[model samples]
Target: MIFYHFGKYILLLKSVFRRPEKASIYKREIFKEMVDIGLGSLGIISIISIFIGAVTTVQTAFQLVSDLIPKSIIGSITRDSTILELSPTICSLVLAGKIGSSIASQIGTMRVTEQIDALEIMGINAPGYLILPKLLAGVMMIPLLVIIAIFLSITGGYFAGVASGAVTAAEYIQGLTTDFIPFTVTVAMVKAVIFAFIITTVSSYQGFYTDGGALEVGQSSTKAVVISCISILVADYIIAQLLL
Candidate 1:
């Protein structure tokens, strides 16, 4: 069954990447999806990122309970943690719940209602028309969101550290500026793109293959989120191993 589903998923991806019948229409759809996936997600992502960074800083400070360690190291630790793991992985997980479920439900509903059948009857490339826009949008916007997350997280750490009297402002600033590896950002972006692809495509696959009615739609949505999350975690580990 897993092999069957995997084969189907691969075929669906091939369909999704097929050339569109109307480039202009696909472009419009891509833009709309970008707005929905990126701008619509900003508030939750921002709030979560800030708090995650703050907690990381506080926890790291709590752990390094020795006079031998410099307080500035807290900033460095927070910065690297946020960039390497917290921002990309956690935000992607959050988005797997939000955007992944939405995609699955939307597509599942369409499938159950025979909207996809109508598209096929009309000679439209249904997968390309529906999923391609989302794929492109995810690829474009998710990395940008991760970049924003990285900045906000570091800022949050700074505020939390200073406010908690855990580190001085000068120390935090110096730590943030010191010994920063530019390649980490590259790794983060790679992870973000892969995670975004997993979220969008896995959800779409669940939705596209959905059977039955409303209850089934909800089931498909749930499955989409679950599968997307699992895929994201697996991909995260693989990317870390290969890239880092």
Candidate 2:
């Protein structure tokens, strides 16, 4: 059963990367789904980004002052962490939770209902049609989401710094700029793209081959989230190592 399910997943992945000779009619559809996943999921990403930045700033300020560390570098620390790790890795996990589960359940349900099979009968490349567009969308939108995450997080951190009396708003902003690196954004963008692809592709695969009935759909959804979460963490470490 495991291999039966995984075999399809591997094949779908191969199909996704297949050359022009292997490409099918489903690529555009996958792109549209990607856009939907990205645009639709923006709210959660925005809310989380703001709060995470605020909390990190608050905590960093408290610790720096409380621990008698250099106060001026607080903003730099916050900025670096947000751009390098927090924004990309954390946001990917969020997407895995919000969008990944949705992809799994929706597709899994469609599978159980025989819609995927019908598409195949109609000569559609079911995997390409269902999975590719979503995968592409995820790959595309994740970087945009990460960029937003960075901006919101940094802004929130600045506010928190002033509100908490750890640093003046201007000082906090100044500290952030001193340590700014353009490549950090590129690093984050790369990570977001990879993470997006991982979550979307894995979730879609789980959904694509879901079996049994509604129970199986539920199981697939749970598995999709679990696997995606784990994959995100693993991929983060791997990608970070590769990039850094």
In candidate 1, what are the lDDT values of residues 7-78, reduced to their tens digit? 999999999989899999999999999999999999999999999989998999999999998989999999
Q: Residue 104: error of model 2 in Å?
A: 0.7
Q: Flag regions of model 2 displaced more than 4 Å.
A: 1-8, 18-31, 66-69
Taking every candidate in turn, the Cα RMSD to the unseen true structure, in Å, is: 0.6, 2.6
lDDT of 2 by residue, 106-157 (tens): 9999999999999779876777667777877788888888998999998988
Looking at model 1, report the run of 10 residues with the lowest lDDT sum. Answer: 170-179
Candidate 1: C-alpha lDDT: 0.95
> What lDDT score goes with residue 58 in model 2?
86
Question: What C-alpha lDDT do the candidate models reach, one value each?
Answer: 0.95, 0.83
- TM-scores for all candidates? 0.99, 0.90
Clashing residue pairs found in predicted model 2: 30-133, 31-133, 34-137
